[model samples]
Target: MNMVEHPGFVLWFTGLSGAGKTTIAVALEAQLRERGMRLERLDGDTVRQGLTRDLGFSKEDRDKNIERVTFVAKLLSRNNVAVLASFISPYIAHRDGVRAETTHFIEVFVDAPLEICAQRDVKGMYKKAFAGEIKNFTGVSDPYEPPINPEIHIHTDQETVDESVQRIVTWLEERQYIPAKVTA
Candidate 1:
C-alpha cells in the first residue's frame, strides 16, 4: 500500500507507567532514524508537561488528552511523518477513537505486570502514586484496560530493548510500510 507515499502512519504504544512504552518507542525511533525515515515521537509524560499541561488525570481529561494527541499524530502522519506515541491510553473507547482518526494505526501493547512496572519505576511515579502524591494513576489508584487485539504485544519482561525494536521494525517492513533489504 505504499505507506511512505501515503504520509506513513502512527505506531501507538499503550500500557501502564514504567511498562517500557517510552523505552521501546525511543529505541524504535532511533532505529527508524538510522534507516532514514521521517518520524516524530510523542510521549505522554512530555506531552502532558507541554501540550496538555492544564489537563488533569480525570477520565474526561484523559480522554481529551488522547483526543488531542490523536489529532496531532494524524496530522503528522498526513504530512508523511511516522508518528510514534507512548501513552497509557487506558480506555477502549479512547483507543478506538484514535484508530478511527488514523488510517495506519498500529497499536503496540506494552504488556508488563503491575508489580514488575512498580519495581522498574525509573521516574518514581509508582512511589508517588503509592504514597498518595499522585491521584488517578493507572495500575495504581486508577484502572488500565488492556487492548483487546493489539497489532503487536511486547512483553518487556521477556524481551530486551533491541529485540523489541527489531520486532517493530520487522513489522513495518512486513507490512510494506518500509522497504526491505534486497537479498544478495
Candidate 2:
C-alpha cells in the first residue's frame, strides 16, 4: 500500500491586533483552496472564545493560550491538515516554542505601524486600550516582540490584501510547501 505523506502543517501569523492578520490569513486560505489544498484556520479570537475561554489576558495567560494553540496546530499538522493561525503572540519565546514542534512551520509577521493599527481598529479595541478601558493589550499596554527572522513579512500598511496573499503564496511555492503548478 502506498502511504500518503503528511500533508498537515502550520502557517503561523504573528502581529498586533488590527494589523490585518485575520484578513490576510482568510485570503491566503482561499488562495490555497483554489489550488486544491485542504486546510483549517485557528484564529486567536475564536479560540479564546472556545478552547481558551478560561484564559485571561495576563502575560501568563497569553503564554498558556499560545501553548495550547501550538499543541493543537502540531496535532493537526501530524494529521496532514494545513493549519493557519493568527495571534498577537507577543513573546518571542512562545513563538520559538511553537516552531520547535514541526518542520512545516512558517512564521509570517504582519508588520503594521501602531498608528495604522489604531486607525484600522474596527473592533474598538485600540480605542479602549488607549483609553485604559483595557489593560495589558499588545502594542498598547503590553509589548509585542517583533520576529527577528520571520519566514515571511507582510507590511500591511504598504500592501494590498491581494498583494500580501500573493507574497505568501509565492513563498509557499518557492519552498515546496505546496505543489508547483503547470501551465501550458
lDDT for each candidate structure: 0.88, 0.88
User: Each candidate: how many clashes?
Assistant: 1, 2
Estimate the TM-score for candidate 1: 0.92
Point out where model 1 deviates above 4 Å: 1-7, 181-184
Give one digit per residue, the lDDT tens place, for model 1 in 1-184. 1222324789999999888999999988876776667789999989999999999999989988999998898888877789999999999899999998985899999999999999989898899999999999899999999999999999999999899889998988888886554333
Return the top candidate by TM-score: 2
| Model 2, runs deviating above 4 Å | 1-6, 181-184
RMSD of each: 2.9, 2.8
TM-score for candidate 2, please give it.
0.93
TM-score of each predicted structure versus truth = 0.92, 0.93
lDDT tens digits, residue span 1-184, model 2: 2222336779999999999889999998877776667688999999999999999999899989999998899888887888999998989999999999864889999999999999988699999999999989999999999999999999998999999998998888786777554332
